[model samples]
Target: MTESGRKLILSYYVSIDGKSVGPTNGMRGVMESIDDEAQEDEYVRQLWEAGAFLMGRASYDAMKGFWPVAEHPSAAPMNAIPKVVFSRTLDSVEEWGASSIASGDLAEEIARLKAEPGKDLFAIAGDSFQRALIAAGVVDEYRLWVLPAAAGTGTALFPEQDGPLRLR
Candidate 1:
C-alpha cells in the first residue's frame, strides 16, 4: 500500500511474442472477439476490486471509447474506481467515468499512493510506464499473464533490458 492512501499495482497480459495486444486483446478484443462472457465478467470484477487504476494516455484513450457502454457484469465496478491518467496534452478527463490527471511526479505519486489505505492501485497497461517504474525499482510486484499462444514477431512486451532480472 502507498503512504498517500493508495496502492500501486501493475497488471499486464502478454502474448508469446511479448506483445501487449491492446487493439486485438484489449477492450474491443475482449468484448467482440473473445467468446467467453464469464471471463470478461471475472476480469472486470477483479479490476474493480482495486482501489484505483492508472494507465498511459494511449491506453486511457482506447478505454474511453469502450468501457462506458460495456454491459459486462464488471462494468459497474470499473465505472466506479478512481482513474488516474498520465498525459501532458489532455486538459481534463471528461470521459463517462470519473477520472483525474496525475498530480505529482510519477515515482512520488506512486509512493504516496502505496502509503495510502487501499487494497492496491492497478496499473492498467502503459508498457513504457511499467518499464520506467520497474527500472526505477519502485514496482513491488510483477504479474505477467502469459497467454496460451505464440507470435513469430511484433511489438514486444520486453522492449529493452538494462540488466538481467531473476524471476521466480
Candidate 2:
C-alpha cells in the first residue's frame, strides 16, 4: 500500500528463490515460460500507468541495449516515459529517450521526486540498487513477478540485515 500521497514502487522479475536474475539459461527459460496474452496486457497496462521509470546505472546499461529498439506491447510506454537513473558514474543517458541520471543523495532525490505531481515512480529492479534501497528503507511498495525456475546461486532480493523488514 502507498503511504501519505506519493509512492516509490519497486518492480522485479524474480526466480522461485527470490533472486532477481541468475544464470543466463535460467533467466531465458523463465522469460520464455511466462509468456501469456493476459499477463502481457496487464504488464503493459501497468507500464502505462508509470509517470516515470526509475533504475540504477546497471539497469540503464542493461536496458539501454534492448528497450530502445524493441518492438513489443510495453515498448511504447517504456520508451515514452521519463526515466531517472541513479548513479554516480554515468555522465550521459542520451541514448535512451527521456532518461536522466540522478547523482544527488538517494533519500533526498527520492523525496524530491515523490513531492512532484505525477503517478507513482516505478522502479526497474537491479540487484545492487535494490539492495541499497532495501537497506535504506526507502522503497514504499514492492512488486515481484515470481517465475518458476531457480538459479543454483544468485543475488537475493532482500540483502542481509540486522532485523526483519515488515511489509503488508
* Among all candidates shown, the one with the greatest TM-score: 2
Tens-place lDDT digits, model 2, residues 1-168: 255446888888888877767455368566666778898898889888888898899888988878879898888999999999999998899999999989999988887888888898888757788777777777898878777777656777875756776667
lDDT per residue for candidate 1 within 1-168, as digits (tens), equals 333555566677776557665554443243245566666666776786788788778878877877788886656776788888877778898884789887567787777667767677788777687776766667665667655555344356557766776686
RMSD of 2: 2.2
**Model 1: lDDT of residue 132:** 67
lDDT of 1: 0.69
Looking at model 1, residue 38 earns an lDDT score of 68
Q: Estimate each model's TM-score.
A: 0.77, 0.88
- After superposition on all C-alphas, the RMSD of every candidate to the true structure, in Å, is 3.4, 2.2
Candidate 2: clashing pairs of residues: none
